[model samples]
Target: MTTHDLPRLRPEVVLGPALRTGPKTVHHIKDESTGCFYRVGPREHFIMGLMDGRHTLQDIGVQYRETYDRTLGPDSWQQMFTLLGRYQLLDGHADAGVLDRFRQAQQDKQAARQGWLRRRWVLLQPDRLCATLAARLGFAFRTGFVVPALALIALLQTIVWTHTTVLAHDASHQRSWAVAVPLLLVLGWLITMLHELAHGVTCRHFGGSVTEIGLSWRFPLLTPYCRTDDIVLFHRRRARVGTAFAGVFVGLLSLAPVTLWWWLTRDGGPGHRIAAALLLFGSAGSLMSLLPFLRSDGYVMLTHALGLVDLRRESYRFWRLRLRRRDPAARDTLRAYPSGDVRAYTLYGIATLAVAVPAYCALMWVWFARLRHWTGPGWAVVVLAAETLVVAGLLLGAARGRRADRQAADA
Candidate 1:
């Protein structure tokens, strides 16, 4: 706090190359030691820049007053230094225990996960060697690659859809669930990896580095996802949107080979059966992601499009506000956003949940009935009831998991 006390920024802390988003010029603060990235606006960047060995804290405050015509408060100074120190962005001298607190926070996070979710196992990263492989594959994001891909997908889908029949049937048509189940599971796992890869590669193509490639649990369901927090630094909406739904696009593209092979082989053959199972599961899962009510790719895309991060929560509050006759106690958070966003949230929020639930239940029922090869109407009804209960249980598990996560954080 003394005028003579000159604090130095850590040599390893690197400011970004100055990205422009909207009206502000911001930089991504990257700590080379921790591999941590944090976003800061121009003013915050100025504060950090002034942390050179020459300028003391008092001098930095004077500089801030000169620049903004107002004295910088102690709270601002505390927050900035606390963050910088927590991330180890400052040199030898900072609040002595901030780094310790940061380490404790990380340890607490690790301790919070109880039984089945203690750790995530990362499967593979093809680009670990030759890191520039993704950069070279940037052409894949362009129309030249996409248009041909789309054409091929259409051709393969057409093959699966129409004019196909069983020709030379195998004698071993006794439904091999034992072999098929394991094989299908492995195939699905790889497909999930492919989905995450699509996101990572798309992000790299759009000039963001892939931080981690791994598998993580989505509530009770184990799903694969990639971390590209660098997307926050990506100023363009197109880049962010492309990164968001890249998995969904890859899911769609994968159908080409599965559908084509299914058509080429005999209907009763193992290849046909495996392909059918994958197609069913992949299609259903991707469709589920498209439900805007749920937190999936489609919802992410919609949220980014609407330019509202809290669309679902705010929209619910808006509706609640209306239902209670504009009660002052209820938060009308959506009112601050643009009129377009308000309307979009209002329509998408309620309508998506209302329609998607039954629609999902119907899809599941049909899928189960098809798998069982149920012939009678009574069997179909039973399948519907079973599928509905399964969906409900999964939903309840997700809700409980979310609550647990929040409680852990609070604790």
Candidate 2:
């Protein structure tokens, strides 16, 4: 194409807000057609931003020169065009190479589908539902409602904390432990569904799409999830943060009625025992979601606030490189990132390891203790062996994921 020919980006392509990592500002470009996300630096973003079919290459070059006091040569222009074309980001037909790569990606995705043990069941497309809910429930996002709700939750939590001993006594004396436990589990699951919906509704309220609301099962764990990835495209950081916090907020809020019930019927009864147990379990779960070490609401909020993509992966990679100080190939890995990012990665890696190691150890100890009591010593040993195999499988999976991430970054 000639310099005067206009280049246009695909209409469905979405450009995310500028996210700063270290000294560089990066922008995310999502190709809705392919469901692929690409990150570009400020210069590429500037060039792509003008690809509206109205600005010719000459016009873009002129603007670029004016802004940065630099001119792009013919080769530079060709390279930029090639990169865009390879990703099929430009409007119109893609070349054979791009089509082949796209086909291969599709095949890879098919091959990588989860097995029966760890599966995802997409219940429904929740975009329309979320939009409707957001409209009707818009007032809930207002400060007038939020402030009082938070205060109520705080007060209820304080009451629960103060009456912990009495609640425990009631729970122990109750005759319906077996029935109440199962009922509490069911109630918790229902609240979890609402929690996912809350995330979708909040994203919709902030003008973001909630494409999927589904259940994901990874063996022993099955939970409802809402795909709020479109929140990244939002210009307002608070909107992104709010979307992340929505699930946890709804989870904690669900305890309000149960807390009230427990307070009113402090008399040692089955109903009161159930209510007390629900309060304790629900509160613990909600608070656990606020720990940044896990891929939970707190982690999501941290990433959004810091504008760092894949913080956990990056931190892990940083530590891996740091530990291999004698390896020449690994030495350059840390140098690629800016000093600020390197420091961030180092600190996060250390903090996560410090917390996660002790926490996991304690969890395993408790697991073994429980298993020993429930089963025999021999059966507990067998169960521990099975658990070890599961952990090994998880580590292998993580390794594969890291390799894939590195390949993507290189590309």
Candidates' C-alpha lDDT? 0.67, 0.80
**Residues 5-43, candidate 2, lDDT per residue (tens digit)?**
888888878888888654457888877666666788889
Q: Can you give the TM-score per candidate against the true fold?
A: 0.64, 0.84
* Residue 103 error, candidate 2, Å: 9.5
TM-score attained by model 1: 0.64
Best by lDDT: 2
Which tens-of-lDDT digit does each residue in 142-182 have in candidate 1?
A: 89998898787666545544433321122123268788788
lDDT of 2 at 35: 60
Q: State in Å the error of residue 48, model 1.
A: 6.8
lDDT of 1 at 43: 83
Model 2 lDDT, residue 174, Cα: 56
